[model samples]
Target: MEASKVIHAIYNDDDVLMHAVKKVKAAKHHIEEIYTPFPVHGLDKAMGLAPTRLAICAFMYGCVGLTVAILMMNFIMIEDWPQDIGGKPSFSYLENMPAFVPIMFELTVFFAAHLMVITFYLRSKMWPFKKAENPDPRTTDDHFLMEIPVHGNQQELHDLLAQTGAVEINVVDKAH
Candidate 1:
């Protein structure tokens, strides 16, 4: 496959980067991606990204965890082996639900957290021992990098990025 030309505009401050994103979008330029040292609030809205459905997935996972906890506790305490504790030999799951609240809460949180991490990894196509795709390492520390495809308008893009307070601009040929 052939390599595609892209522009990497580096910014030192996130405020400037946010403004630059707005300007780039206003100029009808398609921003391929942006990298930052930390999570920048509202960056997704600025980039016009669609809302993520991860929250829904988390809720579902929590429900699944709750269900599992209830079933396991019921089977252990009621059906499999009925234990007479605290002078209550009723052997009913509903009566003993209060004692299992903490367990259910912990399992719910555990499932939501672990499943969300796995979902995010799969969604991002990330796995153990994978190669990094970042164009610049400074973005992982103190810099912000904005990537825009170069469609034979390098000069215009460079000028626009310069006006947006980019500290440096480099044309990169990225291989797919």
Candidate 2:
């Protein structure tokens, strides 16, 4: 494999990072990635990334959970073994629907929360025991880092990053 060079520009403030991203995009340089301590609003739009579909996925998962709850409740209470409880006969699912509402709601939220987290982890390629890919530890604390691949214009890219309020810039050779 060949080793490629990449520029890591460290920024202190999120605002500076956002402006730097816009300037870099306007200059036609492809930004590989950006890391921040917390979610930066409008960063995705500035990076020209597509909107995330996690919300839609969570909705679907919730629907599945609701269906499961309904089917399970029907089988257990109505079909499998019907019994009278609290003066209400479990002969019909519709009659006992009110009693099942808590279970349905709980299962829906549970599935949506757990499955959405799993989906996010899988989509991000973050498997269990995976090595950390963060280039700088400070990004996890209070700093922001922008990574851009060098395309034989190191000097130009370095000068531009410096002009964009980067606190520090380093060119590192990355082996892939």
Candidate 3:
């Protein structure tokens, strides 16, 4: 793989980072990546990234969980062992659905939360013992870092980043 130079611009505040992102986009510069200590609202939109489909996935997972819960409850309460609980031997899932509603709801939330996390981890290419990709450790605490590829316009890009209120800027060779 060929090594290419990239510019790393560090910012202290998220507002400044957002403003710099907008300015960089307005100038037609492509932002490779941005690392922030916390979630910055509207940063994805400003970076022109596509909206995530995690919500849709979560909904589907929830549906699956609800179906499983319904089937399991029906089999257990109605078909497998029709018990005379509270002297009500209905043997019908519909009749006993009210009692199963809580289980269904809990399973739905559990599946959505757990599956969504696994899907996110897989989709993000994260795995056990995976090497960290963070360029700056400070970004994990308070600062924000923006990465832009340098294409023979290092001086121009450096000056532009500096004008956008970057506290520190560095040119580093990155391998792809």
Candidate 4:
């Protein structure tokens, strides 16, 4: 977590930022990261990131949750220890299935919520005891940041950023 070299262009205009990103990308320079105060539509494509797989992951996770809910409720209410306090039959799944819905729904929600949280935590590398990694505070408020690594033509990259109407530019040495 020490020092590494990073060059960032700070922009106040989202339009300018968008145009700038497109220009640099079209020129075939890879953009390392983009930080905006608010979401910008189509920025992901401009940054050359493929569409996210989170939706598919969510669907799969939800299915697992629902399946577990159904199985658990079936085992507990119908199979292991059946009781007939209300004189309702528990011998048939289809007969008592409607009544078992509430617990099934509850468990479904519980599992989905828990598993999604775990997935998010693991995917984002976030842990309760882990230290946070954040950029400058100003970038979160009024400014947007576009970080480009210094591979080659560092000066030309800075110049290109300035030409794109960046209000401020900074070269950071974040090497460890």
Each candidate's clash count: 0, 0, 0, 6
Candidate 3 lDDT: 0.95
Write candidate 2's Cα lDDT for 1-176 as tens digits. 99999999999999999999999999999999999999999999999999989999999999999999999999999999998998999879998898999999999999999999999999999998999999899999999999999999999999999999999999999888
On the 0 to 100 scale, the lDDT of residue 154 in model 1 is: 97
Best by lDDT: 2
Model 4 spans with C-alpha error above 4 angstroms: 1-4
Candidate 4 per-residue lDDT over residues 20-60, each given as its tens digit: 99988877888888888899998998788988877677777
- Candidate 1: segments with Cα more than 4 A from true spot: none
Compose the digit string of candidate 1's lDDT tens values, residues 1-176.
Answer: 99999999999999999999999999999999999999999999999999999999999999999998989888888899998888887478888788889999999999999999999999999999999988899999999999999999999999999999999999999988
Error of 1 at 173 (Å): 0.4
Instruction: Give the RMSD in angstroms, all C-alphas superposed, for model 2.
Output: 1.0
Mark the 10 consecutive residues where model 3 has the least summed lDDT: 87-96
Clashes of 3: 0
Please list all clashing residue pairs in model 3, or write none if there are none.
none
Candidate 3 residue lDDT tens string, 1-176: 99999999999999999999999999999999999989999999999999999999999999999999999998888999899989888579998888889999999999999999999999999999999999999999999999999989999999999999999999999999
Q: How does each model score on lDDT?
A: 0.95, 0.96, 0.95, 0.83
lDDT of 4: 0.83
Q: Candidate 3 deviates by what RMSD? A: 1.0
